[model samples]
Target: MPSGLPSALYGWPGLCCIPLKRKNTDRCPASLASLIINHHEDSKAPQLALVASILGLAASLDWKAASNLNPFEKCMEDPDYEQLLKVVTLGLNRTLQPQKVIIVGAGIAGLTAAKVLSDAGHKVTILEADNRVGGRIFTFRDGKTGWIGELGAMRMPSSHRILHKLCRSLGLNLTQFMQYDENTWTEVNEVKLRNYVVEKMPEKLGYDLSHRERGHSPEDIYQMALNKAVKDLRTLGCKKAMKKFNRHTLLEYLLGEGNLTRPAVQLLGDVMSKEGFFYLSFAEALRAHSCLSDRLRYSRIVGGWDLLPRALLSSLSGPVLLNAPVVAITQGIHDVRVHISTSLQSRSLKVLTGDLVLVTASGPALQRITFSPPLTRRRQEALRALHYVAASKVFLSFRRPFWLEEHIEGGHSNTDRPARLIFYPAPDEGALLLASYTWSDAAAPFAGLSTDQALRVALKDVAALHGPVVFRLWDGTGVVKRWAEDPHSQGGFVVQPPSLGHGDEDYDWSFPYGRIYFAGEHTAHPHGWVETAVKSALRAAVKINKHWSRVPSPEKQAILHRLEHIHVSEDVQQQEESPEGHVFVEAIPQVQEHITVETITPGKGHVHVHHQNIPSHVHEKVFPDVHGHVHEKVFPEVHGHVHEKVFPEVHGHVHEKVFPEGHGHRHMHEKVFPEGHGHGHVHETVIPEGHGPLHPGGHRQMEPGSQRHRHMHSSCKGGGGT
Candidate 1:
């Protein structure tokens, strides 16, 4: 297998089997099967590989799948590995009936979902509010000078494994993003200092260390304390250990047990203040440090960040609608209906229906759009509680590298001044400068200002830091991007408050809410970076895959249960016990053998299993299990009364499982009942996004253009950049 396959084949072996995209992404067997195995390899292997690839297609992503699904029930009873191997000899795959997916937003998360699902042979269509791709990977290039400067996300770090994979797929080149080339200067309050990349950095704005703080660099000290505090949180048994840090704010935690000197605290406070320190939790902040402490290689896309997004768009199999904003999302038992605006200025709406719907828009944007059945209180609350960070990037391109006149190539000049952090681009004579990259309060003063005013203010501060000599020769034009003011995003990325718990990452935010699932960086553990956004989208796509081709498996049900309980937040937990959350269901009374317990992605849903005769005209699709048994065909919508007929069985114990919404029941009766003595019951099986009541609302009320299911493909556009 090693000799015949490409050298890069081993990068994602174990991960390739799962629905989720892990660090390493390898070519799927479906695409490479013919190329890999031939008569020389094995004549029948290709057929087996095709079947195995079917399983690969269906089994796509969840962070928790690896934990519960142990080799799909560990020991197999029938057509064992060797025998099953005769078919798809080289692979163990499950079949999938591809579905229609409607993805909102053409950001990294949205595009990634579209790419993955489409690759798995699913019909995908993307709707983007901005008439362009790449949500935050915004770049501005000078037509005359051909100089590129970032207006949104900047450099890519080597540690961003997922981003690198995409880059690898696109065959994009990466060069050093001289963000810290010269270690520039600092201009705080009145004190001005240079970023002297010497043995000791003593600049007084952000990364400078005084005599007392000499031993610990900001990165080193923050990482050391975080590691010590979160040492237990990373492990499974740290349940009680997490509580101690959960209640405190980052400031309080930093000051705990005299962790730093007075000056050191002030220094740390100045830097962290750029982000929200008062609201951020100690645990969440600590997790952030873990990524920073690891060796970082700050590099940028060779041409510009925008190129990467464009490249991603090119790789996608389907068309993406530009300027198409989904005004309403109506989720039905069968499929989801999304009514999107054909154009930003047009009042006309188009209805797009998909078996699965994935919303990768910012939370604020999501909130503005109506959920036909208003999102459950749980989902609405999460959306409301999740706050977005307000930030702005101020960019200026020059005819020549003025910093080079002083032997400065690239690097940042930290400051508590309104100008904030100034980053230098390449050493090229004509390059761009990130004059001000500020967040929170530091960004407020500049974010709302006009481009000229922002450039004027930023340069004044820069002049103060490095003297006016650096700007004697300048290009008057500048680009100022304040994500907070963007009409589409509505706000910057999501941030955690002190009230956010450590285990909040495990919360099932990515779980499909009915037929719709949410993605974007905010949905994943690492809330800020591009890598997290792509990874998060993959998880949502995988979850949708599981929902589409559900099979009867104890491990899958258990895994879905875990996904269902991901909402361990105290508020949500309390809501589960509340009145609206109450749920009750009773199905078949007994199970003689493996009564096919078909699964949909776990949610507050009820299941009714009948061991009696089911009508053959119902048209059920059967899926072969690891063992010889085949599970019953499943449908997307389970409305009113469902005739769930399975094999006959008698008296058995009730299968108990807890869910957030009104205790929705899933009856997993053991094989204790005798054959031909099946008991029947009347019950309702409905699943919502959260543990809450499902309300039937009005029809989608599609407008004139509703017949056009696809988002109209048009020239990409965005809010004009200065």
Candidate 2:
């Protein structure tokens, strides 16, 4: 028997034949004698492991213990994530034309795009406006004390697979980023309490909460409110859901849909450190909530987050033009011309012509650049009116790790003071503490104040959260970062407006204008995350790679051939029902007989439906009937671009509609830019990334709402589609 084999298999009850490696002939004891079979292949390790697990379950009669082995875990599998990962691990086919590519920004998005295109044998050049790289991934290290402060993107969720893949590829070590801890303190309205006693907060703080909202935490209240507002969003599909949900602000959603009392809503905002973002769009809040949900775990890169970008910079074969801001872009019939301003005093310019130009600059940065024919009215409007939330951080350097005395480790402490959220650095991360972190309206006050003034205000908040003891242990040094004050990035992360577009605000920010392509967190849905920046980079790289010839060498063809499979599987999308009563949905795979069964009464219907794992289609149903009879509907075989009506004999007429490519739904999508290493307040913005979360409204192109300064949003997880 192999050493790695389970010990339980050796002491099983019944004696049976076991599947062994090609050279081994072993008789294994198992209870499932009839199911035993002999296999003579070296690749049977996985099969044998499965059999062992099943036998162990059967013997122990512990179904719950083996729940992890269940196939339902496949429901969590994202085809888009898998396909994108494959692209990162197995790159695109070499280009036949080998065109020249110009990447506008040297941020994570631009760098990733440059690396991919360069690896695919394209001539690539990166023009960075700032002197340094790593746009929002700013890590400030004290020269003397060696303490580090994350001014921009500090932590990310473990579910952000694409980012994890990039970090792993770069050989960066990821350490646990303690986002929440039960021992953490919460101070609001001059009332202090531990997180474990959170359920009793309303009573302790004397808030007149409603009966339903009395016992719940702010997170719970938010979740309940979110569920109520977008309860039918999934079944209703994207277009309908967007229109339905995007009409209100978070405050409105909480009051109307959530049905929470005014006091309860205020308590939630205060406790969650989101009072500044109360007026933000409920749709955008949901987008941020999708990524920052409690279901995910957060971590930070060892050393600093900037290491990932530095590693990416080292891996790139292309040249990066530092301090080179693109002043103008002119599109011609053949290619695109980018004018780079080399010197401020000399008034000199350098022009670079590229077959494709990927502009990874922030929206505000884009407004400064002149375009030849002028961008589309919608694109220009999106650039001009896109909302980037103001975010600020104040860091305090202590002589010792005094918070540990209070048993406060890596978690954050929330307060309703000027410092909305305070992050305590890990024990191994030196004695630097993120004293004050504010977003949206909360950050507005800090943005106008000088570094010294902001530090003083933050210290007062810290003293209020902790005690007067903070003054004794403080090293008399502080640092502040205000995203609004940064010239490179005008704001922190983006927060979509209540109405996506009706006036100046348009939702089509990601679409390419002529040969000028956009690749940034802003271009990605749930924007303002490092992961999204990487995803956008990958997207731009793929689009540019698609410009090459279909015919290539055998090896290159293999890569492209694999991509064709991905496109076939991942291209299937969800759209709204037709104007008429037509509900277009994908056929569920693994369901050989009927995909859905329903019981419909006179008006109400119960539907038991199974969703397909295919990327092209989603599992949806008309309705189940009232009676016990299970109506079996034979779905028509769906092929590429074919419109087949799925007729299921139900109580009412079945309305199934599927939009062919480019027909029904569409959307459009920031970064936090970090500043200098000095204490003068190095403000940085982080744009969330990855595919939109699972919602009734479908893929959200709108950027994420207010996010914690040090911790990332859950929306940063991997998924495919632009």
Candidate 3:
């Protein structure tokens, strides 16, 4: 049987078949069917082989898909392989190199830059000279009361867009700091002033000036004046306003130009000096008012403002080396290296090579760092020209809220003059925190005092305000972090000197060699403010991103894409237009006119005529137009009586009437009242019957009792006769 098989079955030597048989006679044809089935199965082998080969190919492709990685990791594992692969695949990695970005100072600006660069696929390293990340935002826990004391930058305004956004993203909690009511207080001059309810004082003064403004009770007029003044100031740029106001001190501006009285000047000066540093000039004060005009609505931050830096730091993927002080910077055309000292014992100096270096240190710290190729003359001059104001901030936490009880009356207490004391009544954990600041010359006296001495002086000042009550002084627990002594931050913040020159005027203060970029609150727009820090950082980041041509990460790219697509809707556009062109004017209504003329001749040979037009349903209310009356009274009384009459013509209509009943009569009434119910009667009766006619015409000549009757009737008819 095997020999009889077809030649096509020669390759299938192992082929086998089984036949089904119904009885032995029916199974006779089964053998033949089995042979035919074997031939058909043999013919289908090639097709099955093709199908198996296709499935094997698909499995190999799926394995490759599962093992694929991002370009970053691929490059890290095999740099040479990645370069070769890019050359063959996309032809892009020939000149591709990792970017390094060094950020000096681990404050908010530094952290922000680090996060931005890191997210942009750049290698970032942060060098913070201080032991901690927060530079100016120092939070200390009181040993006794266990309350937190913010010795550095504390309150953040609600308008701080970046800070507020960061806080919300971080899920931090912010608590409001409650201020005590102002009651009894003494001024810096030692004058005792009783506190009056601020809400009631304006009503009492009959002027309505808000707390922000000082003036009369009807606040509308004062507000209008302020709005106009603000509009005018805005029309003139801030720099121009500063320059315009710079020549005069606040005192001089208030008294000479602002037209403020001595008392008003003193009150405003005291408030401004206490709130800001005393070093702030009148021009600086105006600039501050302009800058903070938008931020005057809210003051707070959840979990303290320090959370801002912390949140920024958390977003940074790079290493932040705290206590690592950058002593020098060496720059090349393509690479900048920074020398940082980590510790005294190790003396380990790490060289950080970066394509860009951001120096976020204070103005004073920048002055101290040595540059390899010395900073340009222009940059050096800028550093020298910029001056940091010396400010000392002291925070005191008490066991109980004593100041709140004492100053809780109506207005802010005036006890601590020069030093404004804001009592936090129901503080976190029922603790009281007092923050005091002095600037320029006034700050010198406090510099020599220790933490304990400063606390004693501040407590004593508070005691004096509240009448010598016992202070729960934190002796060992008192913490003082003076910015003056801080190495990284040599002073509080930058203050433009009166001699610092004008707006956008190029200052020699460019970063050393232009390779190192300086940014912080001081470098921010409009000078020192928390918002400036974030804004300055963003500006610097934009410059760096532009230089690198780096594609931001997926998350950041999505954000940028979404922002670019955003546009203002038409509804908002329409609302922004001025309404002046849309305003309509209505025509005045017309009424019938009645005119009356009368002549008077007095017995003393004095003749005068008076005229008035009285309208129905309306009566003339007499008020001495004092301004016009003054000018009329300037002339001497002619013939013992200055005869002056007001004849105001309305729309070219003249109604003239004689006084003293149209006869030569002397009227002795001080005033006259029109005939009406509940009206004020004139002091004297109209020209008496016996008196001569006001005019030359006698009553009898006009008519009999009819002449006098007609005269009386006409007089009464003219004035809605009683």
**How many clashing pairs per prediction, in order?**
26, 38, 29
Query: What are the per-residue Cα lDDT tens digits for candidate 3 across 1-722?
Result: 13443221111100111111121211111223234344457887665455334323422333123223111111112113333222222222211223557788877777766666556555566777776777787766655555665667665544344555545555667654332222544345554443323212322322233454442211112122233323435577545654655554554555555554454444443432423432455555544543332112234565466766776676665556666577666543334657554344432333455656888888777766655334544455667866676667666665566654554422234333434543343423444355355655446657878888886776666665656443544332345556777777877777654544445353522222334676787764445566566556655665565544443445433433332221111121122212221111111111121223221111111122233222111111111121342122111112122232222322332221212222312121211122224332212111112111121221110001111111121111110000
- C-alpha TM-scores of all predictions: 0.63, 0.66, 0.55
lDDT of 2 at 405: 82
Q: Which residue window of length 10 is worst by lDDT in model 3? A: 713-722
Query: In model 3, where do residues sit more than 4 Å from their true spots?
Result: 1-98, 179-186, 192-243, 246-252, 274-283, 290-295, 404-419, 472-477, 499-513, 550-722
TM-score of 2: 0.66
How well does candidate 2 score on lDDT at residue 433? 91
Candidate 1 vs 2: which has more lDDT: 2
Per-candidate Cα lDDT values, in order, are 0.53, 0.60, 0.44
Instruction: Report the error of model 2 at residue 694, Å.
Output: 35
lDDT of 2 by residue, 218-250 (tens): 655665565554344546754566566667788
lDDT order of candidates, top first: 2, 1, 3
Error of 1 at 112 (Å): 0.5
